[model samples]
Target: MTAAARYAALLQWLRSNDADISPKIDLQPSSRGGGYGAFLTEDAVEGELLFTIPRKTCITLADSIEDDACGEGFKALIETAGPGGNTVVMAGFMARERIRSLESQKPGSIVDDSSFGPYLATLPWERGMNNQEHVLYWDNKDIEKYLKGSMCYGEALDLRKEVDVAIRVLNTIVGKSIREFRGDYLDSGFQWPWEKAAQASEEKLKGPPEGLAEAVKGAFVCMLTRAFEDGDGDEEKLVPMLDMLQHSDEPNISHAMRKSDGAVEVRARQDLTAGQELLNQYRSELEETMPYHRFFTRFGFVPGIQEEMTNLFEDKSSIFFAQKAEI
Candidate 1:
């Protein structure tokens, strides 16, 4: 199918399954188009399972590249995903298939079936604007040298194919959620606190997706907001999945990757209360500046005196109390 047709089909599939598979989430839109959060429905006790999102559902840029030469030990890494392989493998296969088909009639062509030329040609240029800025691009001379040094003609061809398939798969599965809500105005049907913050701020407050600000320079707030807005709708869904855990400087819920299953799981490190807000420290206090600059700069909420007081007696006091009530 054509790329446009394939995209339509994917969107249809998401919309059809929306009711059955949609996690109990509340969409909170910010002044910026894509700023929102997802909250848990029922109060979850500590160590409770908030949710599980399969890696297949979320796509990343690395998933698209067919170039095994791009990284060392690439073949072994691809084989590790098992027999059917993961999306990365699929991407490689697809890239090869496209390259092969083109090469059949054009044997002398520099762009044969094993090449990533076709897949790269079809990449969504607009969506990649932000990513291009972050990544280091290879010049033709560098690429030619690397490709020659990395593998034989046949092996290079195979790697390019794999890269194509991976990129396609990543684009297909990751952005499903956000695409569904595009072009719609904010709705109260959802009850997200961040949305409330956006409303409270008269839609002026905007923040980056969790974790992004720390990972990328000048990527703190507005850049993330725009990236999500421009990203494949499916990829943007990942934000809500992460947001559902809520926010805590000292999070009871911890993010962990289960290597055995390749699934990212949120496990309770400590017991929790039903109404207690779930939180994961977006930036580590130990690693970053005091009071966590990311939180205050992005969320428009700061750790107040109450947080300081809690820190002072947090170890000894079972419950935190405000100074006004201490009298």
Candidate 2:
């Protein structure tokens, strides 16, 4: 589908989300920047809840093990992962779901879709205006060219290695087919959804590793850029359209997970204009909290924090790192 068409489908699915929770926002091509953004059609006051997503609605690794979707061994793996291994656990869950979606689409079952299919459909597996084109997928040359000498270069490299290891570990536990399926899926330029990928599997493509690569990378991206800390536990979870709102240095909306119901809510940080795009600043206003290179590599764009600020504090990060390491 075209970019607009894809966004249209996503918007339709999001709109059908609980009317009381979903905000009245327009998903249009961003003139302010690349990809689609959430724009308010009506003026909203500061401190007002723009949207709220019930915690249970979110698809998390907790759901994966509990729902019996993942195998017992995989469930044990998730338990072992805990807080530090959120990426591995979530990635496994997503990979598992993709396989289930494939099975459901087979001959006799022909099931419609999974509970998270709509949300899964919205994930950016292929290159698009607002899809998966993370540093994890970047060719090494691109990394060297764009990120060399930057703070995030090493971090990005390390991240890619981590994902590679995660994929391999899953391969050992699940099957080599997951990796093979991912290889073929990547070879196909990542355009295929579950049904398309499933058809390829039928054609002798690997099965267990179906969607493994994308799922792991996608989960990691979401974890780094969008996932939230859940109140019920230390587990990180994603809140649909809320996660889709792009970040800014000075955001107009502030989001937090409600302690009462484990629901997440995004409130206006300031009075917003009727047609303004909802900006959600990913980091705190504390200048030291967000290093420019980290932002660029993690979210795939520089915050354009300006040269003066960079000059002032750039040396400090290295100094701090050295001190912290006592090097």
Candidate 3:
């Protein structure tokens, strides 16, 4: 199906399943930024559904790449994008023009298209907004870093070989194939609905083929196991909904997920007044260096750095490591 058709169908499905909540949502352009997020019209207590966006409604980097091996590179890039093991956990809003251009060109091929021809021909290009290319280039550098790093060496490799084996087996069990789209460059800027397309393209760069949920679960399991081995706790509990909530440092809501069925229940972390926008922190408090920096690094939003504004919670107790060591 064409990208437009697929998007329309997905929107229809969302509207149908979310009949009660759909009307409450205002998907119109956000003057604050170029992306979309949910907001509450009235007071909602803890454990409320807020709104449930179907899995199909969200997008992932895996959706754009054609090969499963690309995930290894992508994961590595994510890791390098931040400090040691505490990488930003949410997917960033990929620039629409860059994504379209990347998809159009064959991997490793020269840019035969015009200087601007390589860009996505979306409406934003016609307007005055600057096409952000640095983010993509940063991701590429991280991928290269991962390719060079090794988890094991020589006979030590034999001891850790099981992890690699597990990852390989999981890959086979949860493989996915994605379709590619060609990028076309047009005018530098445009208006209205055409601009909307640029926003959507950033969110939905590519679509996933069948079995993405299974694939995501399997990958999560493998990563969670490793985290546990490294003194990270029942990290398994955090895996399922990690991707569901997008990143924000100053989150308006707090959430707890039920592991049995991967159900996410959100609650207002603080008292909120009417017309107040809702936010949810995508990563653990221990990892975020500053509140807004999370938005700037991950979503490309300009949240100036402030050392005083660090993540609110941190468990300094060594009990977590002790528990993992006992395991």
Full-model lDDT for every candidate:
0.35, 0.64, 0.33
TM-score of 3: 0.35
TM-score for all models, in order of appearance: 0.32, 0.73, 0.35
lDDT agreement of model 1 with the native = 0.35
* Candidate 3 weakest lDDT stretch, 10 residues: 85-94
RMSD, candidate 2, Å: 8.7
Ranking by lDDT: 2, 1, 3
The lowest-lDDT stretch of 10 consecutive residues in candidate 1 is 129-138
User: Per-residue alpha-carbon lDDT of model 1 for 1-327, expressed as tens digits?
Assistant: 454443334334333433122233233322122222334445555566655545443333333333342222234544565533433433333333333333433635443333332222232222222122111122335334433332122333453354344443332322221122221235567768987666635422333222221222222121222212112232221222443233456766776544664445665567654334445665555654433223332332233322422233333322222223564
Model 2, 157: alpha-carbon shift in Å? 1.6
Task: Tell me the spans in candidate 3 whose CA falls farther than 4 Å from its real position.
Answer: 1-11, 15-23, 53-134, 137-248, 283-327
Question: Which ranges in model 1 have alpha carbons more than 4 Å from their true place?
Answer: 1-35, 66-240, 243-246, 286-327
Select the stronger candidate by lDDT from 1 and 2.
Answer: 2
- Report the C-alpha lDDT of model 3 over 107-143, residue by residue, as the tens digit: 6654443122211222121112222211222233432
